[model samples]
Target: MSKATVYFGIILLLAVVIYFSLGSNFHNSTTSDLNFGTFSMKIPRYWKKIEFDGIDSYIGGITNETDSLTFDYGWYSYNLSYENREKQLFATDTINGKIALITKPKEVGNGTLGIYIEEAYKKNRFNFLGKNILDEQIVFEIFKSIRFKDSDTTLNSKSFGFTDKITPYSGRSLFYTHCASCHHRNKNLFGPAFASINELDFKKWIIDTTNLGLTGMAKFGIRYHQKAFKKLLMDNDIEKLIEYSKVST
Candidate 1:
């Protein structure tokens, strides 16, 4: 072969290799749905799903080389009132038709920042930790793609593990609003399961007016939520909740 023709062929071969390499990288990093039985969310296929055991309140999440998306349960009643609220960046966005509260720290550049989604679904919160705020658009896209299964539908393979399929019942709303974050009907979360709790003790723990000086779990429950329980529950309401739990199963 002529020298010019051989050089041209070498250049063509290198170009083809580079093109395929880039294409493979793009395909491996593309987004896909990550299923969690009751819910599914869109995430980059390159990210690894990590199950957190007990790192503070974090339950589980997915992570990559420098980015992570952790999850935890939170209440809507906890309002945002930080001391340096003026310095930080806060914005409201919509997720699946629900309002989501987004917050970030007072960092200038894209360096070791995080996104906190405290409110949107009233029941759960998501934290996206990373180094670049500019790349946060992916997290918002993932959040927007989250879809929850219908209450009546039966879960396959993996499920939320609520007892008896956890089909909708009279006490469901109350449980979801007040107790679901930390307590489940059958599984233990931050607190003991409803099925494992004593009715009388549970009532006493809720109505903690006289148990201010107690210790252990009772004290922790009463002291931490003294104001909340006082504002949320009355004698009649507590009775109704107790009755609901008994028949919910």
Candidate 2:
């Protein structure tokens, strides 16, 4: 055989070996089943799980070397006025037996291309995180794989191993749903941490401050009154939240 033909045969053998090795690796990797209170999903073994803090209904992220997917669940009254501007609607489709609105940005040249899926359920948002790594078809497949778990089997405050000090778990849920995105227990995101407030009558101060706008903070009482403030401002709810804050801080 010619020298060139011999070299080609050797290269083809190496390529076939590499392909089968990769395929075998993928097939042998173990997958993890995640139960996120409201739902459950299977994650590929190659993805690394990222830990999240706070008492969100469900919060989790799984990342591969070049791709990731993160999901968060919270209760927010739907408001058409508060929709994001940077994202443009890409398509609407049924995913996991629920109506989903898929959106993407007009520009995706920054190495990151996010495809957001908003379900009509009004409480959960699933973000497919990657940099042109996961195509639309793959995202849809992942979305379809999501399975809503039975409410009875959902994880609760006790499952998280919280002590009695963080009782009235509803308040923790409320804080997580409404406040956690912007505020952390000890650190700050869009707003100051809950620990920074040093009010003698913190409950009343919380009510007043949240109701009245100050500096960079909008009057949440007015803005989210119908959506969340009314429920959060209830005497019992506020009391529970204050108690939780005291112990958590």
TM-score, every prediction: 0.40, 0.38
Q: What is the lDDT of residue 177 in candidate 2?
A: 42
How well does candidate 1 score on lDDT at residue 215? 59
* Residue pairs with clashing backbones, model 1: 112-131
RMSD of 2: 18.1
Write one digit per residue (lDDT tens) for candidate 1, span 1-249: 999999999999999999999999898779877876545678887777777664444356777767676655334322334314544455443334333344544554344333344432436554544444456656656655655443212211121121212122224444554565567777788887777777777666777568556453564475566556656666666675677666654
Q: Which candidate is the best by lDDT?
A: 1
**Residue range 166-200, candidate 2, lDDT tens digits:** 12224555455455656666787676676675544
Flag clash pairs in model 2: none
The list of candidate 2 runs beyond 4 A from truth reads 1-32, 77-87, 107-137, 150-249
Clashes of each: 1, 0
- Which ranges of candidate 1 are over 4 A from the true structure? 1-25, 53-58, 74-80, 106-137, 150-249
